[model samples]
Target: MTPVPPSRADRSSPGEVLRAGPLEIHATARQAFVNGARITLGSRAFDLLLMLAEAAGRVVSHDEIQARVWPNRHVSETNLRVQVSTLRRALGEARHVVSTVPDRGYAFTPFGQHAPEPDDAPVPGDHVVHVVDDEADMRDALEGLLMASGWRVRTYGSVGAFQEALTAQTAGCLILDVSLPGENGLELQRRLLALGLSLPIVFLSGRSNIPIAVEAMKAGAIEFLTKPAAGEDILAAVARAMALALSERPQSPA
Candidate 1:
């Protein structure tokens, strides 16, 4: 298998191997092990485990896991639950390393930290993602990818729809088409800023010249990705944007 490049989304070198307690984590090769026994992990499962290990003793919110593991993909929690269950079973009682925080999210305790005192906090809503694209295929593909990686995705086929969605719900990040049906993406971004919403925006299109990319960046796009970008790259940008949004939010974990 090809090694996934290192990104903040993935917490390892391109082909580095990791040994933590009885478990071994080889992020480059996408493999895991416990006590010299090989543990089978799918790409998604490996990504989740890597996120937990990176946190390594802190409780990783559901949104954080979704952003890091799935990136620009959108998926329902059912899939996430199945994968987590499988991982927990594979790890068995060794899963003390991966602790569920009631309605909040999962935490990685590593092998050393003692169990944390219970904290009663409200379980936040599912992570929110916004996709603005006039092309149905592209929108659906991106939404499907995000869902598979684990997030709640909303799609807008027009600027009006995008604006309505923005006002109706909260979004961790925005995936915007550079050319919209009514107004250009740069214009839309200006409007977003005018409204005082600093949501992270990512631009995508089939026409991403250096000039256009530079203009979009100046208009506040965190990244300008071409249409049909690699899944990993798209995810990396999305994860970075989400982390930024999460940091900006004032919600304190109870």
Candidate 2:
């Protein structure tokens, strides 16, 4: 990867600010302030906005956006456009900083004045990580690992527990064990997809082999890890999955 050049929004520099309610976003952190409350952005959106802000006052091509946002597998340009559109709507009509670059790509052009506070609390959109494993020890371990890595972790021992939790809170990524007491992990994944609940999925299978992993991946698993996997590998895969999930999450109106 090439080194990122210094920008006006750098830690030491001052750039145009974006204010949503009480949220004041500096170049760093991409923090959102609402009614004196701080809102956290998911990792992927934070990185994406930072890259766009750093390229403020200039046009960033679609290829550049894809290279920065998704460094993994190839993604379509439409995906990048959708994300940009979502970001714009989230920013509301206060000022349209993100502008289209016609056929080439997009550019940042700040407009409009900051508005007064709205009456309602801003709906939170932080990335959440969910773990589902039958073993108590493994469930606790994964939760601890994900929390230490700065993710909001939720754990479940069975599919019933997971389903109940999903009713309360949505997750950005799912770490699922293939074999569960009630519904198998793969079966659960299939169900989630059928119900239109699509999040990045990582499968952990004691029986994970070429065929099993391939089947899981074909069934929409992002990555499959066999039992006795190293912690770092799991963390990396989770991070990647979280990033993908963040960009894919359905956005509410601004």
Candidate 3:
């Protein structure tokens, strides 16, 4: 198997092996092997795969993909298509997980009848990310990555605690788990919305149900991620969430 060098995303991860059905991805190492044999991926292909993997199931648009893969220069649509084809070859039969949405973008599954469209609304102030996940490991992992990346962060093991904290400090973004002991992330999101709290929400889940993801998107969640997602993907989502929060932030009196 080929030894894949670490990427920026790997530094924040625990170096554990991530399993998605038959594929094995080493997050810390930035390597993928199938049946113990290494799969070769060009730099662009790897970046694309990592982005999709971290999305947790959200459809990543062509523009977003280009921005990630080619941050500076303009990449032609043909180039994007070529890179996608290459990634599909690497995934082999498992590639079906990456589904194309004509006129929209690419999603991780075929179950979604439509695609998520991000708003450019702006909010202001520090973009603190408030994370709520029952798993201590998950919470720590996110905190380490987000804080190290220069984002302000606060974490809670439950929605109630996060809610309590919100009264004092409004988080610019919220990263939450779909499953919790009581009052899951979706419920908390609804509650927040009712109270006029529209912070960008990003959902993480080990149990991925398409309908539920759709529901979260419908409720205005920035993104819904499935478990074992790459830290890079989480970071990308957080960036998006923060941008939304900044746009949505109320205007201060001039």
Q: Please report the candidate that would top lDDT against the real structure.
A: 3
Candidate 2 matches the true fold with a TM-score of: 0.51
lDDT of 3 by residue, 11-65 (tens): 3546866555556667667887666677888777777877776675677888999
lDDT of 2 at 136: 98
- The parts of candidate 2 lying over 4 Å away from their true place are 1-126
Model 1: CA > 4 A from native: 1-126, 252-254
Tens digit of lDDT per residue, candidate 2, span 123-205?
23556778999999999889888889777888889988989867424758899999899799988988898878867888888
**Sorted by lDDT, highest first, which candidate order results?**
3, 1, 2
RMSD of each: 13.8, 14.2, 13.3
**What local lDDT score does residue 199 receive in model 2, on the 0 to 100 scale?**
73
Candidate 1 lDDT by residue in tens digits, 1-254? 12221222344356766555677777677887788777877788888888877665566777787788888887555445445645765764355566555345666665655434254232236446788899999999999998898767889898888776566236478888888877878889888888888778878878647677666666656667777776755765676566556656676599
Q: For all candidates, what are the clash counts?
A: 8, 2, 9
Task: Give the TM-score of each candidate.
Answer: 0.51, 0.51, 0.54
2 or 3, greater by lDDT:
3
List clashing residue pairs in candidate 1. Answer: 73-145, 73-146, 73-147, 74-145, 74-146, 74-147, 75-146, 75-147
lDDT of 3 at 113: 24
